[model samples]
Target: MGIITDIVLPVSLAFIMISIGLTLTLGDFRRVAAQPRDFLIGAVSQIIVLPLVAFALVTAWRVEPVLAVGVMIIAAAPGGVTSNLLTLFARGDVALSVSLTAITSLLSVVTVPLIVVTAHQHFVAGSGGEVAGDLTVTGAVLKIFVIVTVPVLAGLAVRHTMPGFALRFEPLARRISAVLFVLVMVGAIYAERANIGSYFAQAGAITLTLNIAMMAIAFYGAAWLGMRRPQRIAIALECGLQNGTLAIAVAASLFHETLYAIPAAIYSLMMFGTALAFVFLVTRGRPAAV
Candidate 1:
């Protein structure tokens, strides 16, 4: 379990990031400049509002401190590649979804550390004295950079240098990433199998509420902001789906405790069901695409 949490999880997360990178290009980032207002709308909704909402839930619910930190970690995560695919399914703006996911992912190297450390300070440290092996901002930034930014950058370089190869291999890499995600969840759960039922019981309601709340927030916010239907759908799913793998990695690797990862793991499972229903609800009785 130690080896799996410390080593295997990090390596697998890096590869998952690399797979996400395979689908990106410089243009994705440039989409920010190309459409700054819309991008800002989505960015604020995600990077700013999501964590704020999580904190509210944590504070309102008075969740267990470590688990509250876990909730924050998952909330802090960027959108995952699955959101891009779901955007396609919802007939939303795939290009916009890809752009949002790519930028948030790159931004996470900083954002994740900040959120985690803040949550740790507020939840764990505030609740009790400082625990041993507390995660510092600097240490978390470095760890996330090594496992996240560098891998995504490497994948981008591969795509640029070998477009044909990247095209041929990206699907395979994404499939492998999916398998790895499942394995990581299983490993995390198995490691804490004894407490699994309690963790889920404690975590299920909050995580599910977070997922549904954020989906509603992003969707209605987009609509209220006068975004088109497809853009609204894309923003909604992107905010809802979160990078749980990265959240788990932080809990398991940075904090050295899979107990903190329980919410993220459970959140990861709950999201797919909600996302599928979201897609169905939005896309039903609709045209194939815009």
Candidate 2:
């Protein structure tokens, strides 16, 4: 299990992220500059607001310290490729969705480490002193860069160099990513099976609360800011669905703690159900695409 968590999980996560990159083009980044207001709204909501919300929830719930940090780690993770698919299905702005995913992921190379280190200091060290060989900001930053950023950049390179090939392979890549995600979820659950029920009992409600709150905040906040329906839907899904595979991999590979990965695995399951219901509500009377 250690070998699988430490080795296979990270590698698989990198592949999933690379597959995401393969779907991206330079235009995805350019779209942010093209429409700065919409992009900024989504980016701020994702990179800033969501983590703050997660922290507040964990602190309010008096969650176990390690699990609190784990939840924070999930919050710090960038939006997943699943958001793009959900956006498409929800009749949202798929371009904006992809742009947010790409930008947040790149920014997470910085934000994730900062948030995780802060959570560790506050929850882990502040409460009970330090754990030796604990994850440091520098190590977290480097590992995220290597595992997340590098693969994404490689995928972007592939897209740029072979546009046709990239397009042709994207559907298959997405399918592969889906499969890898399931396997990672299984690995995480299996690794923590002994304590699965207790972990879920501990973090399940908190994670569910976090997920629903984020979606509502994103959707209502975007609407309040007068964003169009499509953009609102995009923001809602992006904020709601995190990159759980990355979160789990980070916990298992970087922290080597099954308890740390439990929140992510549970959150992954919770998000799908919530996201589907959201899709149903938003799409009931709307056109297929806006």
Candidate 3:
């Protein structure tokens, strides 16, 4: 059952990626060229600043070395598709949000493994080998490319080859993806059920603090970058949010380490409540998007 659950996640994620590709085009990226500063800010914050923030939070919170690496992996993850929905709700620039998601997702094939390996090495050195066993550099890289990049490319290929068929399948794809995402959450919870009490006791505060901190970093980072209101909201949503479900899948399937999966599991639970509150605060009294 655990092995089957592992297979389901990447398959569902592939469908979700295909749906995104079907809805996007090169023109979306071209639009970013007209707003170079916003594009640069969003990219840099995601690729550089956010991961650093995660590392700092882990250290400051005194998270266990293994769990700290988990936090960094989640941090290194791309902006989720859900951010586009949240941006739409916040009356943000949907195009910018979509563009950011697209770019970040493309970049994660390089960045995620880099972040994971770097964190693994750092924690191993710092903790005198108390880190979660290192995921082999070669195997980790191969799995990331195969598991993440392959599905994204396959999705894109389907979109390119059969636009009509792609459109027809997208809604169903989304519904399936949504259901699978929920199931992943449920499975994660069930898998962690026995350890829930201790997991929370050991790392709940760290997880909560990191969640709030990153969200705040994203919000303030966007504003500080002088992004317009809508773009700021979009960047905030993207920066703070992540695909924790995917992280859980990586931990469970790719890494086969349930203990290492707990941080993402905790994050999956925390983000919904926090992100909803953020959408409320940012969008509550604002006029609706046109």
- Tens digits of per-residue lDDT, candidate 3, 1-290, equal 27436577677667666666765666767888888788788878778888898888888877677778878877888877788888888888888888888777767778887887788788754668644445666767777777667776676777778878988887677677677777776776677788778887776777777777777877787787676888887887787778776676566655546766678778777877888898899877666753
Q: Which model, 1 or 3, shows the larger TM-score? A: 1
Q: Say which prediction, candidate 1 or candidate 2, comes out ahead on lDDT.
A: 2
Tell me the whole-model lDDT of each prediction, alpha carbons only.
Answer: 0.88, 0.89, 0.75
Q: What TM-score does each of the candidates earn?
A: 0.97, 0.97, 0.91
- Looking at model 3, the pairs that clash are none
Count backbone clashes in candidate 3: 0
Give per-residue CA lDDT, model 2, range 212-272, as digits (tens): 9999999999999999999999999999999998898777656756788889889999999
Q: Tell how far residue 89 is off in model 3, in angstroms.
A: 0.7
lDDT of 1 by residue, 1-290 (tens): 67778677887899989888888888887877898878888888889999999999989988888899999999999998889889999999889998888888999999999998988998999888456395689999998898889989888899899989999999899788888888888888889899989999888899999999999999998899889988899899989999888888878767766778999999999999999999999988987845
Which segments of model 2 are wrong by more than 4 Å? 132-134
